[model samples]
Target: MTVHVLEPACDWRAADVADETRWTLELSPADIAELEAALACAKARAADLLDVTRDDFPLPSLAPRLVEIEAQLIDGCGFARIRGLPVERYSDDDAALIYWGIGMHLGKPWPQNKHGHLLGDVTDHGKSGADSTSRGYELGGVALPYHSDGSDLVGLMCLRKAMSGGISTVANALAIHNELVRTRPDLAALLYEPQPYDYRGEEPKGGEPFYSMPVFTEHAGRLFVRYIRPYIEASQRHPDAPRLHPKAREAFDLVDAVCADPAFNVYMDLEPGDMQFVNNYHVLHARTAYEDWPERNRKRHLKRLWLETARLTDRPEKFRNFSSHWAQKRTKSELKLDA
Candidate 1:
């Protein structure tokens, strides 16, 4: 099978983004004051985060900057770090309010997982990565393999840092695609074919326990990739799931090898108050194993949001309006913030 080979606008190497100045946006003191003021107003009105709108938490000064960020996420490097939120001064609830408010300007919050959780907690929930039903975010102290989230964009706001390790890494999948096309076009072609993926126990009721999606797709002159090696391997447990093709396995390995190379990955030790946003289609993210503080208050924690951006005019049919999980919509539920 042959695939169209086009130069992706998001193609970028780690060296190209090594300078923090390119992707890091440090909020000014005024920006912090504005955010705090909005948080205060929202608190005063007892506004629920799910109900809060951009108009409710206005960012007169930061709104334009967010628009710029939206552009950068789509047309530029596909990932960014917004630093300086003074998270230490506020409680986790307050910090989440601020993060959710900021996220409002970027895009509409989509549900994370089968649960209709517009807001998600990224702290470890005692899950094991080795378990077929375990989600990486729910498993603590384990290194997450590079993978894309099911959303147009994914954002994480750091509330606490781990005692050690847990550095976040992002790789430019567009660059990986370009490299594969240049070096192993045959393997790259295999990626465009559908591959089986385990649903991780979130399978639709009365439906198959697995689903099929291509690792790479090109739509309207754009490159889109959805890769999760662990899930693909786990699908083998289901007797009814189609077996993975050997060529597809080779393609997965090639992509994994390219993503692991330092030449393609940008590593960042996310600190308290750091907010990171990545275009899920163009970037693959991972986290290193970490040791957490014994104290619950000091344990590593981050709030996450999966957003559907208005910037993309077109996307693969499976991704449109969260169609991939349409059959499982009845199971939608939101995760509550820990007290």
Candidate 2:
């Protein structure tokens, strides 16, 4: 197998971005005012959350900045956080509206789950981590391994934080891939082949329980990755799924090790009202196990959005979401568990 060294704009290490200010954008007072006005406008129109569009929630002063953020997501660092949203002043519904509006300006909303949820909640649903049907975002108090989602970008808005832990970590998958090419081209080449991924019980009726896609794909000189360690491991449960080659297993372990290394990843402790966005193709994101607060209102909760970015015009057929069945039912996921 022939492997080539390819470098992209997002191939930076942790040391290269040691300054938090480089990736963190703090909302200005003027920006906050614009957001408030937009929230009020949307509320006055009595627009449903799904019905709200970018024009309905105008951010005249902040829209240009969001355009820059969109570019950064596709062409630069591949991850960013916007801080200083005074969540204490707004109700939960109002805060969600603000997040939805901001997401509209960035990209078109994509359904996150099989339920066709354009909007989603990231909170504990009393799901057991050991359950094969459980998704990482549906459970709490467990570390989520680094993996890419099924979209051009993934956004999360923090409504509340955990009592302890739950730090968000993002690693540069481009850097990891390039490193593999340089050090172990054999493993890297192996990853470019098709690997089976379990659907976690969400496969369409009578459809295969597992689907196959390459872990690494290069198109138009850009690298794209889709990796879910648990899903890959769980695919073994389906006897018909392709068996993992021994070298493929070694390659998967190396990817995980590189992501966990301090030199390759950066950790962020998000506060209430902070928003984070990552390029799903270039970055692998994860969360640490967290302890929730005793009070029901204080438990960790985040609103999620999967976005189809306009900047990314083309993709490998395998990366495109071909699950039309997901669109058959459109509803938001608002599951909550008793504290």
Candidate 3:
């Protein structure tokens, strides 16, 4: 949905990842029906707003219904298993096209994956090497180490898959927080403190090349966590970030352990055309890397989305980029596209 008015004043506040518990809402006939209607409405509305044509875009009418599904994904039951969308019926690049359309109804598009990014399996550099964007390479290949990108929610729509070894994994951030707060309050306290983060050049013009916020925050009794340790650690490269206390390091380690726990996570094998979205602030997601047998033509490719669902929720004071005083409050400035 188009933001009615730009929220005046750039608060530049980012909210903490809240500790709201998430439950899987299974896909049902009723849910599918609702989603179809919403998607159809959102498509028409979005196309109209963009001043696009029905024939060129091939959009279905799905706005109101899309908003309903988006609300459910954000605030109601956490995550849902949705089915019967066009995504479930196709493969190849066109399936990726459908995902971009559905995502518009769900949340604001992300910067780097603005509108959408091609979710194809190609030989990108593994942890041991650099990234390659070759077509027919492993796109969305599983076995990737656990990590989260900058998005309120991530929608993954399956278009094709590797013959084997591409299971998706997700860990609940709340579970990790609860365990730490109960067993390691001292460490948890550090997470609650402001932490310095590398801007990665997303800062506003004239702003410093970095910002500070905590890995976790709490507001209205909800726990919110946002962690990309690699980025956090990179901030140290600036020579200005505060030194992490020994206790703080331990807390980070503890949180990592919880995320690795099988008990607090779920595994998914995305089917052709199935779209799955997870709350980035509440979930830590990863994939099992796979070896693609290119000779057989079985490859992995999926479309990805970074969404911002305006779920009127409270977060810890430390999360300022999304809703904090430290963040730019303009909702948007230049639409960086690279984010």
| lDDT, each prediction | 0.86, 0.89, 0.53
Identify the runs in model 3 with alpha carbons over 4 angstroms from their true place: 1-72, 84-93, 113-143, 200-209, 295-298, 313-339
Ranking by lDDT: 2, 1, 3
Q: TM per model?
A: 0.95, 0.96, 0.65
Clashes of each: 1, 0, 52
Model 3 over residues 1-339: C-alpha lDDT tens digits?
111111112101112212322322244565545444544554555543222222323323355555666675555433444344554444443344455555665665554321123232223323231222211122334355555655567777665555787777777665566666667766777787877766654555677656777776655545455786655666676776787677777777777777676666667777765677777666677777765555433455555656666673544443322442223222211111111
What's the candidate order when arranged by decreasing TM-score? Answer: 2, 1, 3
Please list all clashing residue pairs in model 1, or write none if there are none. Answer: 116-333
Evaluated with lDDT, which candidate comes out highest?
2
For 82-147, candidate 2 gives per-residue lDDT tens digits of 999998788777888999999999998887778899899898878997899999888988989999
Cα RMSD, model 3: 9.8
Two-way lDDT contest, 2 vs 3, winner: 2
RMSD to truth, every model: 2.1, 1.6, 9.8
Best-fitting candidate, measured by TM-score? 2
Q: Which stretches in model 2 have alpha-carbon errors above 4 Å? A: 321-323, 336-339
* Per-residue lDDT of model 1, residues 1-339, tens digit only: 776555466788888888998898899999999999999887776656677877888899999999999999988999999999999898788889999899989998786776657788888787877777888778788889999988899999998889999999999998998888889989888888888999999877788999999889988888888898899999999998889888888888888889999999999999999999999888999999999898877888888988888898788787765565642432212333335
Model 1 ranges with Cα > 4 A deviation? 324-339
Model 2 residue 298 CA deviation (Å) reads 1.0
